[model samples]
Target: MTVTAADTVPAATLEPPTGRLSPLQQWWVLTTRGLLKVFRNGEFIFAFVSPALLAICFYLPLREAVAQVATIDYAQYLMPVIMLQSAAFVASSASMRAAVDGQEGVHTRFRVMPMPTAVPFLARAATNFVLLLVALACGLITCLIMGWRPVPEEYGGGVTGAAIAVLLVAMIGMALTLCADGIGLVAKSPEATSQLVAFPTLILGMLSTGFIPLNQFPEWIQGFVEYQPISQVTKAMRDAIGGILDWQRFEPTLWWTLGLFAVAAVLLVLGTRKAAR
Candidate 1:
């Protein structure tokens, strides 16, 4: 006997099963999704272009002067520093984007999702770190094209040193981003936020070894400059990727970076909690 149409319920009309991902899985998915967004955004190219171009232009005339005092190529010496500068910019931009997202209610949506609390910020940090690495690789290639050839032993040591320095910088970036995200929440407008972030960026970039060597400054000013986190990181980066490996110089900077990261961790926790409320 044929069943009446009203008596037979279709399986498709039933509610679909809602599957939730584990915390770790959710974090991974969020991170991967963030990375994909970065790739699709054409942001990688835009991020690297200005810095790379400026580095090339700035190094051209200095090549001869650099060759006179050192056996090593000056472009190679400067490449790491340029990478640091570019990475800092990329990190700041990432933070700014996060702030924008928060302002636009995107972060709020993520908060309601099944994702972990840490995923959004961590995903931003991961994406920024990857972009920074890409910028570094490109900077290195640019150096090579400019006739900078690194010695094998020196290269290995430099790589190790650069890695350490970058790790610290990434921590600093994440911390700053968290702080910025908090600031963005309260700011009445994006323009206000931009104005707030600009000076610190300029001051930190200039005061550090990013633009010029620390020794170029007067002796009395050197003490304060050396103590600043930017200075320490830049010094560590420069020592790692530029000249001879010196643990004496490297150790202190490394410690300072770690200390800054610890402080940043505290700030981030407080900031995120505040933002949540």
Candidate 2:
């Protein structure tokens, strides 16, 4: 069959659809498609393994050392922080992937499609959240193996409190991912993006309550550290898991996390819009 290019063209290509997807439909479709892609890429497995390995190889030893000095079980105190660290690292990398797509012209293609421009970012955020949850599960399993158990009877600490803490940490991850998206737009080049965003995030992850207790630091440093988003988020997660369950005391940290997220959202919206243009 020797058909001309014009003859072979589809009727839809000859006359493209006129209507756009509804905002809700667009978001749903994009998020689902993005998640499917992530699953196909084995991101779920990678997320689990990376954190589980770190928890075993790094945190276990640190747990042993901290156990000697700390009144509470070190693994119990450290698990929540590990979850946060895993979330933070994964979220940042996810944002970098979004930026890479932007640079590769994939984002431009999506912008021109009948979908909302925010879909890619939203999907990335959702994927990061899912991956973080998996990481949290892996961490909990590791803690259990290391002889750290949740005292459900004491302070009503059970799955409910742990789940709430996970959600909060995931929200913090979302905020950080947005911030990374903004940074990715600024860097444009992958190499530059890796150096600029990755290093600072790693440093912040270490300095923030991820590795050591904030009280161990100097008073002056503690004041500044307490104000950081990571610190507040970590504190909230710890309080939740430690069975303190004091929402009133943790509310301030939650508010701070929300404020930081709001800022990051604004930055992401502005940067993505600018990049699209």
Index of the highest-TM-score prediction:
2
TM-score of 2: 0.79
Q: What lDDT score is found at residue 216 in candidate 1?
A: 62
Q: Give lDDT tens digits, candidate 1, residues 82-181.
A: 6556655664566566667667877668778767788776776666667766765665566566665544453454556556545655555555555555
Q: Per-residue lDDT tens digits of candidate 2, residues 184-204?
A: 665567677778767776777
Q: What is the lDDT of residue 130 in candidate 2?
A: 67
Which has the greatest lDDT?
Answer: 2
RMSD values for the candidates in order, in angstroms, are 4.4, 4.7
Tell me model 1's lDDT, rounded to 2 decimals: 0.63
Off by over 4 Å in 2: 1-29, 218-220
Question: What lDDT does candidate 1 reach at residue 104?
Answer: 82
